[model samples]
Target: MRIGIPQGLLYFKNGRLWKRNLNALGIEVVTSPETTEGILSDGIRHSVCDLCLPVKAFFGHVLALKDNVDCLFIPRVIRVEPDAFLCPKFIGLPDMVRAAIRNLPRIIDTEFNIKEKPEAVFWQEVRRELKGDRKMLLRGEAEAISTNEILRCAQNDRKRRNDKIEKDHRLQKFSEHKLTVGIAGRPYLVLDNYLNKGVVRYMNRLGVSVVYQTPEKNYIIETMSMLPKWIYWSMGKEVVSSVRRMLEDESIDGIILIANAGCGPDSFMTELIDGTLPVHKKPYMSLSIDEHLSDAGLQTRIEAFVDMIERKFKYN
Candidate 1:
């Protein structure tokens, strides 16, 4: 069967895993095209005004793939961590999509609440679909995890190589000095070039190495233990933990959190980080992105932040 997957929201982080796992089961995976103006327009037409750009983009992706695919895979992700849950919209995303769009392919929405056993939900839901292929499911899970790791390693290597090249070129001006900035946001906002308006590129051009909130798996797990028990949103907790980790790191000169306008979890995270970081005296900037946000204003704010960091730390 051909399964359609929307390339938005959690897809930025888990798309590879889903593709790998589905392909392992002899299923053809059809992904929606990257975000574009037409896709955004379609999404806006279908989605309510209050939904964030990423969610709206998700709707667009769904619409784009509904005609050709046999099934649509939009997981209802409840929680990934123990005692923490996902955003309400994320948990109810399948329902929202069903309500917003018209006729579509069969949606395969498996609820993934990893707060209990790691593979309990996977085994329970996947068993229903692939009743006779227990071995395939096991193999797919392993392969997906391994594939994701390989991709992440390759990305980090590429970032390192690019940073070295940029640093070598700027050596004469600053003697190999570069500011390290930690970026905190949802995976979609952090990774999507269109959604973030190439903010990472801007930071790299400004001679700063950008460290995302999601670090090595072990590092994130270890650092999360330091956070307060009340920050309960799964993604929010992770972002906030990353911010705290960056704040504790002496090499990180500043932090810029990109929050989506009207995102409750992001708003809460921004406020939590803003309140906590002041005690450490670290430079922190929070920028909100919405459909109304402009490229010029974003560039100005980023340039200003970079300038302040440079003047304060003498880093290039």
Candidate 2:
């Protein structure tokens, strides 16, 4: 059987694992096309005016696949880390898709609170949908675990790169032609070139290297341990924790915060980061995207930000 996955939101976070596991189970999986102007418009037409841009974009992806696949796999990812949960939109995403789009294929809406359930149990939930052999399910579970470890190793490699940058104080000198700027926000926005209007590429065009909000997962755990209060929202905490860690790196010259318009949790976190930007000599900017956002405007903002960083960091 074929399963359709929307290429937005949590999919950006877990798509690799999902694709690897389903393929292992001998199930064909199809993904919606990347977010684009046409997709965004379709999503906006189908969704309520108040939903965040990423959620609306997700609607578009599902709608695009409505006629093409046998079933849609919209997992209700409730909790991944301990004592934290995803935004309400994520928990209610499948329902939103069902209400917004018409005549979609069977939806495999499995709920998972990873903090409360084991990996085996989550696969078992999928097994109920497939009714596949138990041996296949077990094999898929093992493959899923291996996939996760591989992703963790990649994150560690990123940490090592960051550490190298930190040790080279000369790299922090603004006079250097190449500069590294840390971009922090939801993975959906950071990872989606269309959604972000190619901000990462634009940065590269400006001779600036971009570092994402994704730190080694273990580093987030370490940073969280130092906090006096536990963050209840997983994504928000992850971004903030990454920012907190990145702020200390001398090699990171500036920060650009990308957020979806009308995202309450993101708004709070952005403001918190804005108000308490590190005392060091780093500039910060926040860009928010909505259904009506224009790429021209976003590009202008990015250009201005890059210019500011360039001037400030220029070797004296």
Candidate 3:
């Protein structure tokens, strides 16, 4: 049986684990194509009004593999990192896809809670759903867990070795170039092009260098210190952690936060950020990303936010 994996949303975090696990279980997997306009169009056409752009893109991926694959791997990844749940929309994604598609494709349901000893629910669910033998399933589980640990270590190493990347960027001495604006947000927002109105292009057109803010030493330190003790949500941590680091770095002139509408934790943190930003480097704006593209008000907000930052720091 063929399984379809979407390249949107949690694809980056789970790609390696899913591929390795399923392959070991002797199941063939198929993935939706890279993000493109056609996929965006498909998503826009089928998605609900309240759905976010990334959720829409997710539907686009599922729609793309409608007939070709036997079952789709649309996981209900509510909590990948302990008590920190994924976006609520992600929790209901399976139901959304079922409604959007004419023929509800078989979906392999798995709940990933990192707090529960590393992919335990995942292996249990996968073993039952995929119908793998005892030995095969056990081996796949061990291998998959090991792969994640190795990846985590490598990510840690990359953070340690990132001095070179930082030094090179610093040495460039971009005095003569366009403004360098840092877009610091969750991976879903930063990586998603359609959701954020092609932020890279938008920033480049405005003569701005977009800085990527993923977690590192500076990011973690700033997050642990700045974010409130009660903001224990995982995705919230991702955003706050990066934003803290971005604020500390002098190289990042301004910061942009792109989040989904109805994101509870984001709304709270955005308020916290806006209220507290006056003390830090203090150039920051938050934009809510949704599937509805016809909202002119949203466009105005984005334009105004960008323009505000540009005007404030243009001469600096």
lDDT of 1 by residue, 1-316 (tens): 5778998998866676667566654567899988887887899899999998899989998999999987888888888667778888888999999999999877887888877555434634643564343443544443344434544543564355423422322322332337878777887877776788778778877887777645554566665565564667768866877777777878888888889887988888787777654524778888999886468999999999998988875654
> For model 3, how does the per-residue alpha-carbon lDDT over 195-307 read when each residue is reduced to its tens digit?
66676556665666677645764455555565456366666766776777677777777777877664666778787666654535566777777555565665576567668
Q: What is the C-alpha RMSD of each candidate to the true structure, in Å?
A: 6.7, 5.8, 5.6
Better of 1 and 3 by TM-score: 1
Q: Using Cα atoms with residue i matched to residue i, what is each candidate's TM-score against the true structure?
A: 0.79, 0.83, 0.73
Candidate that scores best on TM-score: 2
The lDDT for every candidate, in the order shown, is: 0.74, 0.75, 0.65
lDDT of 2 by residue, 1-316 (tens): 6778899997766676677566655678899988998898899899999988888888999989879877888988898766789998888988988888888888888887878886557766775676543434544444444434544544554445444432231222333347788888897877787887778777777888777645667877776676666568988788887787678888788888888787989988887666554624577788887755557888899899888878875854
Candidate maximizing lDDT: 2
Q: Which 10 consecutive positions of candidate 1 have the poorest summed lDDT?
A: 166-175
- Sorted on TM-score, best first, the list reads 2, 1, 3
**For model 3, what is the C-alpha lDDT against the true structure?**
0.65
> Looking at model 3, which ten-residue stretch has the lowest summed lDDT?
165-174
